[model samples]
Target: MARVARTCLRSILKIVNSTLGLVGIAMILYGFWMLRVLQRDMESPSFDDFDSTALWFIYTFLSIGVALCLITCLGHISADSSNGICLSCYMVIIFLLLLLETLVAADILLNSDWEKDLPEDPTGRFHDFREFVESNFDFFKWIAMFIILVQGFSILLAMTLRALGPNNGSNYDIDEEYTSATLPLINPHSQTPPYVVGEPRFSIKNDAWNANK
Candidate 1:
């Protein structure tokens, strides 16, 4: 029963870890797509000069981290110690990546109006810039926030899964634990002091015979 339980647990952990890894990769690619769109729309003359290069680096790192995490999780599920450190490393990377994304999203939302107050670029036309943002604003904001939340939760879950150790594998020493628990109960009075060589002895047999006589 114990062996079966461990096997089931390992399988579940692997599945969940793999799923989250895929999610991380997808988020990175999505961020890249967003950046591509921004690059094309953003002109040097425009007042909207938010740097996205930092975010690109962050997303790229997260993508690589997620790939490594997936491989490590598979190793764990298979009861292999090859990638034991993968999950912990992955969690740290995810937290940093997601936190950065959330901060960028917040900055953009709060400073959207502020950008308009800046001196317009001498070269690029600012025609309908506000309307463009207004049309796609919610879509971008919600997606960014949602991805960050997902990454945060994934990091937490990955850490928990790593701490849980291997659930489905039977390499653990269950027999040792069982024996340790049962050994004390097997002979509770064994530890009590034994009869010494010259201990006091009462002669109840002789006393009973004399009383009868």
Candidate 2:
């Protein structure tokens, strides 16, 4: 039962872990797609009119995607090996990432003027992002919720797997100190006789002071 539970948890963890990588790859492709779309929409496609903020959009998404993919790969390895240290580090990194995402989500939810605080985009690509989000608010909201739930569940699975420890189920382990060649044939304790109390044991005999006595 314990092994089955661990197997189930590990499978779930692997599935969740793979999702992060997929999302990362999607973001990477999305960044390129956004760039292509912007160029296509322009009357005169050129980099001269490209804004630093627009470039930032591409780089930022790509960087995030790479990082997430790396983390996801690590998660898969840790889950497969059931290494305690790897699981611990994975949990901590996931927790920090989750916390950052949560803060961002909360800021978006609570601060309507958040965009005003952002740097201006000369190319006005951020306006497109805002429009996209606003047009599909429900879809984005559900995606955000799903991401949060998966991240939280991943942390939990990491903890559980770490607690379960590695399953060294093979019967190959042996005590190296007691090989067949070094084992004793007789018990060491058997060489010594057990003590008993009796009058003969207490009585002391004396020899006469003669050479042949």
Candidate 3:
């Protein structure tokens, strides 16, 4: 019974960790896609343009961080002793990455001066693109912000669930560990109950004693 319980737990942990890892990867990909759009604007050159290569590097770093998180999750699922350390390190790294991304994205949205210093002018095409994004960037910024928030929340929940153990069932009961009255008797034909203690019924040497009594 204990073995089966552990096996089921292992399987659940594996699934949870693996799923979270894949989600992290997906988030990184999403970031890459957004960056591509921003890059496209930069290539044509915009006043609000950013360094596409630098942004690509940031996404690459985030991708690496996500990979680290996946390794930590794998350790947890495998029940390795080092899992705790790995998880702690990756948690901090993930949080920092989120913060970094948020700051960079905010700068891209709120600080036009910072954009002015960027190298989006291979041929001064960036000035034209800036005028275009200046009008539509707000909507895109809100959407990107929402996605980042949701992704972060998902990571937090996954971490909490992983720490608490497997999420097999929503409800758990300690009473189920004990045999209850509702359970069927194992040997109905036995006059003596399994858990009850009573006087000895008979002994070969006490046959005469019983008869006399």
- Number of the predicted model whose lDDT against the real structure is largest: 2
Model 2: pairs clashing at backbone N, Cα or C within 3 Å = none
Per-candidate TM equals: 0.40, 0.73, 0.38
Candidate 1 differs from the real structure by a C-alpha RMSD in angstroms, to one decimal, of 13.8
lDDT of candidate 1 over 49-71, digit per residue (tens): 55444344335545665664564
Estimate, for each residue in 1-213, the C-alpha lDDT of model 2 and write its tens digit: 667778888899999999899999998888788778767767564535654555665677789989899999999999998999999999999999998998887898899888877766656566787799999999998997898888899999999998988876433234444454355545666356687677563233433334346
Off by over 4 Å in 1: 1-84, 113-136, 139-142, 167-169, 172-213
Error of 2 at 50 (Å): 4.7
lDDT of each: 0.56, 0.81, 0.55
Task: Report model 2's TM-score to 2 decimal places.
Answer: 0.73
Name the TM-score of candidate 3.
0.38
Q: How does model 3 fare in lDDT?
A: 0.55
- What's model 2's overall lDDT? 0.81
Best by TM-score: 2
Candidate 1 matches the true fold with a TM-score of: 0.40
Model 1 scores worst on lDDT over the 10 consecutive residues at: 121-130
